[model samples]
Target: MKRIHDSLIVQTMSRLLIPLAQLFALYVLFFGQYGPGGGFVAGVIWTTSMILTFLVFGLKSPQGRLVEKVLHGDGVGLIIFVGVGGLCLIGGGEFLNYANLEIPGLDAPARRYMGILLGQIGVAVDVAVTGISIVLSLAYHDIEQEYHV
Candidate 1:
């Protein structure tokens, strides 16, 4: 099989398409509550873009360093997700009960919307980070085996 980086067409297309894919992922993430797409779809799309970038640029490249930078995002996202639920509990409701979220200015419906959106955002972030981490681990393993490290 032809290596992805060895194909000029593949490299050029991936460069051109990665940004567009990520943008679409954002759209899916934000509009998910009202539409067919959601955090998981968006996260998968984003991860696909990152994978394409890694294939084209190699893991040592600047773009690939993004994976390292975002490894901690997994925890942050989990915190956001759990924090939202904890807030609901503090508001005298069950975990993840958005209707019980007691923000100062927002009413019940608005609170629900905000809670769901924030949760989805958290899920997206966590999913993206986890997927990227898995790919990075695999790549590192391959490298290790290749050089017998």
Candidate 2:
């Protein structure tokens, strides 16, 4: 419940760095289809940002707002994954059948690509949320246990 850094230089640098770090992580996550990065690497990057925020600014600091949102949206990740799967099912195929989805003004291949992108996003979110939760649990177990009761 305290800002861990003592120096103004560290704090100012952190404010500039964390958001940029998170943006780069998200770029990796979203652009995975065209290049090398994917959900796993992006999730790790995202988790690193959360852990770094917690370390530099402490859990109660305003700098951790993004991490707090990630914590609260854990279930949302699951819902997104399931909902995408359900979309495949509703599109007249088995669960997660990306090829069967139909989109207006697009061919089957385009729909397939869209489905793949959506699936990747869902997985990325789920993995990132899970990683963030695990980090928080391990790092702040004592605080959580003390407060949740």
The best candidate in terms of TM-score: 1
Q: Among these predicted structures, which one has the highest lDDT?
A: 1
TM-scores for candidates 1 onward, in order: 0.86, 0.84
Q: Which stretches of candidate 2 lie over 4 Å from their true place?
A: 1-3, 141-149
Model 1, 1-60: lDDT tens digits are 123277788878877899999999999999998889998889889988888787787655
lDDT of 2 by residue, 4-114 (tens): 667788778877887888899899988898999987788778777777787777665666665767787786766876887888788888887777665668777887788
Question: How many residue pairs clash in model 1?
Answer: 0
| Worst-scoring 10-residue span by lDDT in model 1 | 140-149
The clash number for model 2 is: 0
